[model samples]
Target: MSLDNLPDGLLLEILLHLPLQSVFQCKCLSNRWCSLISTPYFTHRYVSHLHTNLQPFTLLFECKDDQSITRVLATNSDEPELKSLAAYVHRQSEHLWLEASCNDLLLWRSKDDGESSPMSVYYVINPITRQCMALPPITLPYHRSWIQAGQFRVYIVSSNTREWSESKVLCQEGFELTHFALCAVPYKSLLFWCSNSGRLLGIDPYNTRCCRSFEQPIGWELDKETDCFGVCRGYLRICQISMFYTRFSSILRIWELKDYDNEGGGKWYLEHEVSVNQLVSKKSPWLNEHVQQKYPLPLVLAFHPNDGDILYLAIELKVLLCNLRSKTVEVFCDIPHDPDTWNDKCNIINFVLPSWPTPIPFAPLQNGA
Candidate 1:
């Protein structure tokens, strides 16, 4: 009748249904459980099961100045929880930069004293396990004599080998990139990053040099301020808002990259388009004028994993779930902020982990399950 007395197969079945965090905690209960759970066969099965169920997505907001991370469940209305990531860094570490996230694995850069060090300080974390590991540093190539050298690298831990690997990317030829728009979700064994020049670079975690490159969606200028990229149902999604200099109106378009792995360059297919005027008129009529001048259009957060018609967006300090099917908008939750105290020095940025049915443990697969 006791859990320890249960058959091994039944125990694993029960563990597979448990949340990923709980499963990780269960590993510490006993050596038998740990060995069984850590087995390659069990790990892959658990991951495969979770992927089929479609886990709910979570949002991680970074307070730039304080270097603190806040986690909120995007599926429902909930208060944000400040996650303590201090155990991973030195006590003196003040700032942790969120470079990117894929399959619930977060990539962070450590800023020590703001002075450029030849060694890169990067960390990879699995929020569920509360585990963090630092990566070996690589010196970046100098750009121009005056400008400091900055390189973008993605550190991905192999599920099979349990080893960390990184991919190095360069600025596009004939074009100078200031920053890159990190993709919301990684797709098909590739992590996609969009440069300021509207170029898409795909990083192959297995091989750094075999990386792939593609042009951005036609006619889309992915300025860091106005446009962003996300993944919905394993498709590359880009939402862009453009404003006219002469007129006060703005246009918003959402497109998906289809057959992105095509032999020829893949084509972008328009998924949905809406006008800022219509959204303002229906959602916030009072702020019609402020939208074009004072406020930027809502940034696309994440698309619903099961429901293709639903997507999340951030406007002002609120996260809204916009449904294309009903043409309705509802507030999912509010971004954490202090109204009593106003400080212009604080850094705040919002991000959503778009990978649905988040990837499971890294244990290699055995024979067929």
Candidate 2:
């Protein structure tokens, strides 16, 4: 095609359909296409244009290269330059990598070459803008040794400066129960889970008050000791059993959480709960389309970023967009699989779009990260 033949706007539209890397490649096609793609007008269109306004979704997987794995971002579109963002916080778990992305800011941690230990670092980077803010050193008040089998998680809340509180989840099998507290928040609301005693506690961070707690009904008795439940939902979720036990005849529930005295207390009213059979049947057609593969775990669910009345879920083969307004669920296909679809090898992780963007707190990348 003759580059000069097309109107500038038409050329811009064509470039918008391609990923940034491919646009870079087109630079070799001709000086005109190259110069036009570099213009602010074309760059803006290329950044914002997406087939679905649906927040972009990407998959996270670790590649083992000589006992060291490099993590990178690969969208459903499979842009070839997805590896350009490689060299992020190098030593991290799948969960940590999945947690890095928020609205537009990506947070990650890496090792400090000079220090004996990996760098206890945090940075906010925006791939689109390619800006990063590396935060000053932050240390948890408690001794690391005190925390048993501990792991750290960072929660980024939206603010002018992008609020982030680095915290760790601590547990001790030797103690009466496993302890979890929010170290980054005002005061510390520590939660205690006793798989042996079937007890759950919520402690006021400021006064260490035994705020309020509910015991799962006796029917969840085994949960008191041998079994364990973790909150997959965010801050509002508490998985302690009902204080009273009834016949156990239902599936896992998504009970609506209620707040009391500025703390989560009182009975949990279910927002919605689907039985095992119905939930299975609903996903069956989609699974059969895959020619029979075990479905991914506790199907990921989250509030749609743009719509309050809807929620979104991800299965192996497709994304399920549920309309809360109409109380109907619609299945959409966006996942990419080749003719070699019998996929295995890596575990799948699900995450929502980041809601906050932090300043790029990172040191200047070598020629820019």
Q: Could you tell me every candidate's TM-score relative to the true structure? A: 0.69, 0.43
Candidate 2, residue 307: the lDDT equals 42
Which candidate should be chosen as best, given TM-score against the real structure?
1
Which 10 successive residues of model 2 have the least lDDT summed?
Answer: 179-188
Worst 10 residues of 1 by lDDT: 79-88
Residues 1-369, candidate 1, lDDT per residue (tens digit)?
A: 999999999999999887555676788999999999878898788867756544455555444345554433334623121122222222223455566666556677665443466455676665545555666565544321222224555655665665556565554563333223433346677766655545666766666665666666666755533355667777876666776556565666777888765454577787777655554435555445544455545666656655667767666666667776565566667776531232322222333332222344433222210
Q: Give the alpha carbon lDDT tens digit for every residue of 228-271 in model 2.
A: 22332232332222222243222333333344345555454544
- Return the top candidate by lDDT: 1
| Candidate 2 Cα deviation (angstroms), residue 115 | 12
